[model samples]
Target: MSDKPLHPRTRAIHHGIRRSQYGEMAEALFMTQGFAYDSAEQAEARFIKAGPDEFIYARYGNPTSRMFEDRIASLEGTEDAFATASGMAAVNGALMCFAKPGDHIVSSRALFGSCLYVLDVLARFGVEVSYVDGTDLDQWRAAIRPDTRAVFFESVSNPTLEVVDIAGVAALARAVGALVVVDNVFATPVYSRAVEQGADVVVYSTTKHIDGSGRCLGGVICGTRQFVREVAEPYLKHTGAAISPFNAWLMLNGLNTLDLRVRAQTDSALALARALQDMAGVSRVVYPGLPDHPQYDLVQRQMGAGGTMIAVDVGSKAAAFAAMDRMRVFEISNNLGDAKSIVTHPATTTHSRLTPEVREGLGITPGLLRLSVGLEHADDLIDDLRQALA
Candidate 1:
């Protein structure tokens, strides 16, 4: 009952636990779609304004979902959070809540293909969108304007693993009174300083790291209470983007060991990346943790770890496929941040929708293969890749 702030690892497990009278050891799942009212008057009163513990319908909020939200908010150092059905729902809700026609938004060009599609959707609605090189301060400074409503970017971009300067971009947004919305999926909550670094809102595809075993799809938006409750909740609740109670319960359990899993994966990723660089078949190796990475200093200053992803160019599409076919330890799949190591060829799978020119611009080439390092032994993973490359 002490008021001393708990560390993130401890907070992830014990924070925001709302136990039933049974006082069950594990967090209880509330699977009901609706809560009963004491009477007609109480129902009307609840509709007017519900207290923290109260719930009306599953779409609006549930105890299980709220528990996940509170725990994530505590770890991310945000006032509140809203859970969503999927990662894309979280991304869409965060931006669509406040963006209106004619509003200006500047985003990094190097983003997941889906994120770029979302920006295109916004543009079709008359919102002006601009793309900038995320690692370049000059480009961000020029792209963000006085009238800009928001600036968005991934803290560490997908596939290519380009690290963006969150503080630098946030400072520019602050100058113009713009909101800074960051997708911090790669920089898992264990290493996230997004809120401290001036990000007004931080988002994660909890489907990735949070659900490390890949059991469910979920995401969360971390921000001030006003934004979560007022701006985002109203839009999300109405649009029916609520996550299922069962999924929320699974996500809560996922938070318990998130720190342990991410750290192990990140270490394995660093080792794998170093090994890839020495292989004769590898034409390029890109991982923020490596000293030769373009944004190596930024990764040290920002994330303090290279994270769990690695990008390797195996010389050509044919070579990349041959190596992937030969791999035994790594599985071929588009999903990252899993307990099982996953290797994805972005140019053909995740980023295939992008035009060839756009893919080239983002450095998602025919030979590029994204490796999401898992919880396996580092030496075993390296040997597997080495043999595959040979």
Candidate 2:
């Protein structure tokens, strides 16, 4: 066979497949927690240093989980990966593994509520974190100190839909030898070139676009083999953050159609964003793909597509709730990247935990409705939003 790399679509389907003696057509699920050893000496030797195909405990690793890790690593163009119980587990493990008491970390101020909570947890543990406006390169440059251990940010800010300059921030981090850790859930693996753009670590919530149907919760940390095996794995396994084999299998299957699902959803999102902008009730529409977005050029350079989420301001909390109530096709939920379109009032749902002042600073207005566009036809979705706005 010719020595050539496969396309991402092909890799998503065929990579990391391990078939059993039965030679089953489908990927077999190995659900056992512990592996039995052939001999006492063999078990000791394996535990001392498990080979690529060996496993001692489920919390440490499993064949099905390994398959999910390998496939995602390949897709993300990373040397290795570690699957976690949820997206937050991956984020916590990635940041907390190397962050010490005195170590300083810089982060974009616009982050998911849970991510902010994790940073708070780290703060209580003595790690110093500085927050900066992610859209401002100057803010990032000013915040990163010589002692900065890592810089964390959502590649695309949640709810408000601000797109950060991945390459610009990565360059700043490199100057101080700080690791660039990116929450790339919004970018989706299909549109991400985070590794190529100089990110040291890329994290994803497989429950979102990767699963594509809101079926299960899973997350993965993708980076160098040293980071995955030596740094992240030790912390995650010891803390019991391993993804269930069943969830891993579901994520593996989710990867197969990720490209198709995300692209379709993105198209629907753009349509809705454009329609919302001109609608009578909507005062604003935030989507990276829109030409008027503050970071439109960055979105084109980085993701090349708008992505599957949009945020619209319908004027007030009452108006937002009324619009959501009037929706025919969209479901009311906090989750994004689902096959069924979703509408969430961020001030009341996802980001409600944040103080009102903080939410306003992040542009999560009481009137803001976060839209997760689904696989439905663009015209149908647009019509649904039109009536909702009407």
Candidate 3:
């Protein structure tokens, strides 16, 4: 193979490989839990210090999982990556690995409910977590402390679709010697320049788009080799958060078409956002691609395109439900980043766990609905919405 830089679509398919003796055309799944050695001495040496390509136990590493990790790491432009059982596992592992009791963490107020749980629950255990307006540079600067170990935020927040300035936040964190950990889900790998823009660590819930068909649940954390192998691997392997080989294989197949799927979905999303902007009963539309979005310029600079998700605020909960219920093509569900478009009502679903005051603070209103655009034809989706609104 040539050393020339390959496009993401090409890298997704060809970055990682482990050929068997027979040289199978597809990546073979090593489903076994353990690997065999030639001799007792070899096993002993492996236990002490395995070769770079060797595997001792499935918990620590597996061929299929390694392939998925390698492929994602290459796409994210990171030195290494560790696969996890789920997206939250990746989030918790990344934060807990570097955080200790009494350490401080700064995060954006706009986060998925589960992420808020992690940060708040950690606070109960003596960790200090401060929430700030992610779009505000001054808030981030004001929140950073001398002892802050890490700063975490979604590059584009959940439900509300707020876009945080990754470069600005990373620069602020770097000044205080804090690691910048970004959950770059909304900004898919197809549009992500997180690593190049100064993110110290990047995390993804591969279950969303990577498995475009929704066949499996998986996540990965990408960073420097030392951080992934030494810090995250040891904690994840021992805690049983390692991904299954089967799921990893499924994700690998999904990777082959990720760029294609995400781009198509993003196109549909932009169209949907534009169509909804002036519709009756629709109060506001939140899509990074839309010029009306508060951070439109930052999104253009950071992600190039608007992305594949959109959020709209109808007049009320009743109107939102009517719109969602009347739609023929879009499914009403909480999940985002799928091949099938999904609509979610945040106040009663994903963000319900938050107290009413907290939910209101995050702008997850009764009328707010999040839409994850898929590979459907833009006109078909628009027609469905038209009839639903009428």
Candidate 4:
């Protein structure tokens, strides 16, 4: 079974199962901080030279966490993965593991506000970081320097949903011997081929689509085994950024239906985006599935679908707020990729720390509203939006 190349859906269900003596149907949660040994000599041998499937500490590894990591890696087509306490932990770990003082990084200017702080504030302590327009090949080309250690970007950026050319940027990073790191939240793993397209590392906030129920805060960094086990695991375990066994269990359950939920939400998002495209007060609609999107061609080639998120410029902040307040079904919130529909105002919420000028540069306008479609009926959500806009 280990040598067989099963489909992703199959792997998600059975890839990392380690049955106990009881041979339970579901993966068991160890919920332990440390493991015990039979004798002093046995403990010494285990520590000195661990076997193929040995456990040292919960922070280092656990049965539940390992199951979630293995399942996600299989789904993402990566060699291995490291689960983290939260999405930001995954983001920070992925970048901090391979970077050091005097190192340089090139990244997209359009990113989640927290992600921006990680690169701009944290990385600035030692590493030199440069920001560029992710969609422009020329900007990325110019930003890559001989000293660039890595290039990072949200494959489909946050609120605004700007799609980056993963293959193109990966090519540039490869030429400069830099790793290509992608935060593939918007491009849910169901619709993502970042690895196949050349991404060296892919990060996800399992808090989002992976735990579609909004029940847990978890994240994972997926990449080659050497990078995941050797690089990410060391930083994560030492710094105490490991996901809880309970959270890992929740995420593992979430993975079982990730494909179905994301696809359903994406269908609703497409319908809603199209329904509101020419509606009154909507100045612009940004959805990769739309022909008018700047990177629609690339989106079709790379993602195969527009995805489960949509962004709209609703004329002004006042109008955007009015629409949000009027919506009965869509909840106004900052968190996304949940079972419930969520709307966010990036300029004032997620990206509020950025100056108006910087926000504008990223197309995060005062009137822009980001909609994360959920498992609601398309017509119901459309009608709610219609009444709100009316």
Candidate 5:
């Protein structure tokens, strides 16, 4: 059974089961801060070399969290993974673990607000950083240098839904011997082929799709065993960014239905995108699945779907606000990838803190509204959106 390979959905359901003697059906939650040893010598030996199942502290690791890590790693096509407190923590830890003073990294300019903050923090610590238009291959090629340490970007950027060329950028990074780290949140695990596209590390905010019901906040860094254990582990464990056992348990449970939820949401999102695409009130609709998308070809080549989120511009902030206020089915909130459909006005919410020039550069106009389609019925959502426009 251990030697047999399984599908991602199968792995998501039963990848890292360390059942106790009871043989419980569900994964057990090991809510513990520390573990005990039988003898003094045993404790010392365990400290020096902890066995695969043995654990010293919850901060370092726990059975429940380990299961989450292993499960996510298996799902992500990586040898190992480390769960973190939040998605930003995973991103920061992943980047900080690999980079130090004088090391350089190239990043896409279009990123979530929190992600930009991480890069700013990295700069203060003496790391050199460069930002480029994620959609433009020439910009990435010019920015990535032979001495660069890593290249980081969201495969599908937040708010704007700008799809990055994963294989294209990965090739450029590889030429410079740089590590490829992708934030694979928007392109959920169901559609993610980042690792196969030459990414060295894949990070996900398990808080999103992994915990689809908005129940828990957790993140994971997936990569080779050596990188997770030797590079990321020390930083994550020492910096105190480990995930709670309970949250890990929630994430584990969420995985059981992730494929179903994401697919349903994607279908609804596609329908909503098409419904709102040509509406009089909507000036532009940005969904990779849409025919008008500049990167539609790349989206097809990369994820094979438009994903569960859509962005629409209503021509002005007033019109966008009016449309959002009139919507009945979608909740107006900043969170994305929730079971409850969410509508976010990026210019005033998520990306509000960004400079005007930066926002303009990334095309985050005042009228831009990001819609995270949920598991709602497609027709109902489309009707609600149509009513909002009216």
Candidate 6:
């Protein structure tokens, strides 16, 4: 094979295919908990220093899981990656690895409910956390400090779809020697060049677009080899947030079609956003792709497109729920980046626990509905919405 790097679509299919002597075309699933050594002396030698191809325990590493890690790492343009049991596992683990009792963490206020929970948990552990408006560089500058250990945020905020300035924040973080960690779920790996944009660590809920089918729960942490192996891996292996071999295999399968799936979904999303924008009761189209969105320029400069999700604000919560309920093509769901279109009422399902004021601040209005566009025909999806809105 040539030393030239492969395109992401090609890499997704063949990047980490470690075929066994059986010469199987599909990647082998090594469903094992522990590896046996040739002898007692060999076992001791192996424990002293495990070789690259050697395995100690499943929790520490597994072939199937490693393949998933390698494939995602290659796709993410990162030096290495660690697979986790779930997206929250990846998010919480990445933070926990470097965060200490006296350390300060500066984070964007716009966050998923679960992402907020991780920072909340850290605060109780003696870590000082400052929440800022992700879109405002001023808030980030004000909150970030000389001793800040890390700055965390979703590159694209959940439910509300706020787009953060990654390069700007990365510059702020770099000035303070703080790591810039981004949860990049909304911006799928298909279009993500977050590392190129200066994110020190990028995280994703592979459960969303990577799996594309919503088959299994998985997440991956990607960063420099030193950061992934020395920081995150040690904590993960000991604390036990490893992805299963079965799930890894599913993720492996998911990668094969990820490029195709995400692009289709994104196109469908942009189409739907346009259709919904001027509708009778719809007050706003919150998609970054819309030219009218507050962060449209940032969307163009950052991800080169609006992305796969669309958030719309209807007139009222009752109208929002009614619009969601009347949809025939889109499933009422909390999940996104799936094969089937999904519409979520954020005020009731995902962000329901937040106070009305807090929800309002994130732009997650009472009438806001988060739309995760899927692989459905654009015309049919629009027609379903048109009738529902009427």
| TM-score (C-alpha) between model 1 and the true structure | 0.99
* Cα-based lDDT for every prediction: 0.94, 0.93, 0.90, 0.91, 0.92, 0.91
- Per-residue lDDT over 21-105 for candidate 1, one digit per residue giving the tens place of the 0 to 100 score: 9999899999999999999999999999999999999999999999999999999999999999999999999999999999999
| Selected candidate, larger lDDT, 5 vs 6 | 5
Q: How many backbone clashes are present in model 3?
A: 1
Candidate 5, residue 263: how far the Cα is off, in Å:
0.8
Comparing 2 with 4 on lDDT, the higher-scoring candidate is: 2
lDDT tens per residue, model 2, 255-351: 8899999998888788888888889888888899999998898899999999999989888999999999999999998888889999999888888
Per-residue alpha-carbon lDDT of candidate 5 for residues 217-266, written as tens digits (9 for 90 to 100)? 89999999999999999999999999999999999999999999998899
Candidate 1 ranges with C-alpha deviation above 4 Å: 1-3
Our model 5 lands, by Cα RMSD against the true structure, at: 1.2
Better candidate number, 2 or 6, judged by TM-score: 2
Model 6, poorest ten-residue lDDT window? 46-55
User: CA lDDT of 108 in candidate 1?
Assistant: 95
RMSD (Cα, Å) for all candidates, in order, is 0.8, 0.8, 1.1, 1.5, 1.2, 1.1
Model 5 weakest lDDT span, ten residues long:
274-283
Q: Candidate 5: which stretches are off by over 4 Å?
A: 1-4
Could you estimate the TM-score for every candidate?
Answer: 0.99, 0.99, 0.98, 0.97, 0.98, 0.98
Pairs of colliding residues, candidate 5: none
Better of 3 and 4 by TM-score: 3
| Comparison by TM-score, 1 against 4, better one | 1
